[model samples]
Target chain A: MRKLYTKKLSKKDQLKDLEARKETVQFLLNYSKALRVVKCRGFTFDAILN
Target chain B: MNNVEITDAVLVREYMQGNETALSKLINRHHHRIYSFIFSKVFDRDVAEDIFQDTFIKVINTLKRGKYNEEGKFLPWVMRIAHNLVIDHFRRNKRMPKFDNSGDFNIFSVLSDSDLNVETQIIKDQIENDVKELIKELPEDQLEVLTMRIYKDMSFKEISERTGVSINTALGRMRYALINLRKIIEKHKLVLTN
Candidate 1:
């Protein structure tokens, strides 16, 4: 399976991979904040839906 | 320095001086990354949070004893403390972490609050799960470095300092981590084509 990505990935693909990782990092950081909020005050599903 | 940095540095110094609020602020600022790093390694949120608090307690104690020098980057220094706590935990547990098949062990699973549309949340969860699977296939050293770099946000230099390896070797580990992750993704045929 490594053969498949190795064949398709160019330098451009590497750049895109890096960009994707950056976005994931930002998502994870924001996700951390969300978890903290939940810990302090349980899920707010009703609040969100209201 | 800015408020955050000054606040962090001040808190570190104050905690060193035995101010409780300052110590709390330091934990509030850095607990997320530290917790996430430990959670990813041990794959248990409850245990992760326990270790997270323990790490801070150790830091506070160390500071009071004048054991920690006020390094310019308080964040990195604090992370080093958390990293050591995690290693100690694994040593004490005497068991390797098993893959959590139910997706319960995926740290990101907790993100699937009912607030978001169910479909969107599920997709996000699936991606995170696939990423974890890909990580499992990476070589141990590459996996450790990738976890440290990505989850902990530690710079190559910091990782080098902590691991006692050269900076270039740290950078090379990151490069290999990415390359190996891409390989693993392809091997599993997970559709990350880009």
Candidate 2:
């Protein structure tokens, strides 16, 4: 009975890990997409004097 | 072996032997990380670029004078020099706190005074895009934490809450993210150009 209970718990842990990884991946994809549209304004040293 | 395959110590030796391209290669290999580190600290694109140029000019001059001591670890040595230059800039501007006891001297604290020229804006955007490309290589867990910490400038607690993880897990992911990113940079021999 104890062995079976441990196996069930391990499976639950694996599912939780998978869920976390999926969430993380979704966040990164959205963040990278957002980065594509972000604008920045600044000058390089070469451009400043020229 | 070609210049790219040569080790940093060997390149330094070749540079010392009066081969200008060897010096150029050495600079090209490490300039991106050094530049990004300075930019992170200063947050002023023009100032960062100037300091980046100055850091290398100083490096070349020091190498020519035979003053560079660290033989094998050129990048870290040069990074230290660049960091000191950033601190020196703040000191010269009188913006650095006298004691810095509170330890609140962050780049975000320094206000930038850059005019929004179109060309400059485009250049800055290109650099950011390049950085994003590098960051994209990180694992999902690491990528999420790193993006939040860096681009979003979010605290670990905020990141944990948003990601639904404990603070420790959030911090761990960030650490792994940095390690993974460094590995990717080395594996791909990425050269970030501005």
TM-score of structure candidate 1: 0.38
lDDT of 1 at B92: 75
lDDT of 1 by residue, B1-194 (tens): 35545457777777555555675566556666666666666655466666766665556445654667776688887678778888888887767644444522566544455576877778878888779777988888788888889889998888888888998998898899999888877777778422
Q: Model 1: which docking level applies? A: incorrect
User: Where does the lowest 10-residue lDDT sum fall in candidate 2 chain B?
Assistant: B96-105
**Candidate 1 Cα misplacement greater than 4 A, ranges:** A1-50, B1-5, B95-194
CA lDDT, every model vs. true structure = 0.64, 0.68
The Cα error of candidate 1 at residue B116, in Å, is: 47
| TM-scores of all predicted structures | 0.38, 0.38
State the weakest 10-residue window (summed lDDT) of model 1 chain B: B96-105
* Residue runs of model 2 more than 4 Å from their true location after superposition: A1-50, B1-4, B95-194
Looking at chain B only, the TM-scores across the models are 0.45, 0.47
| Candidate maximizing lDDT | 2
**Just chain B of model 1: what TM-score?**
0.45
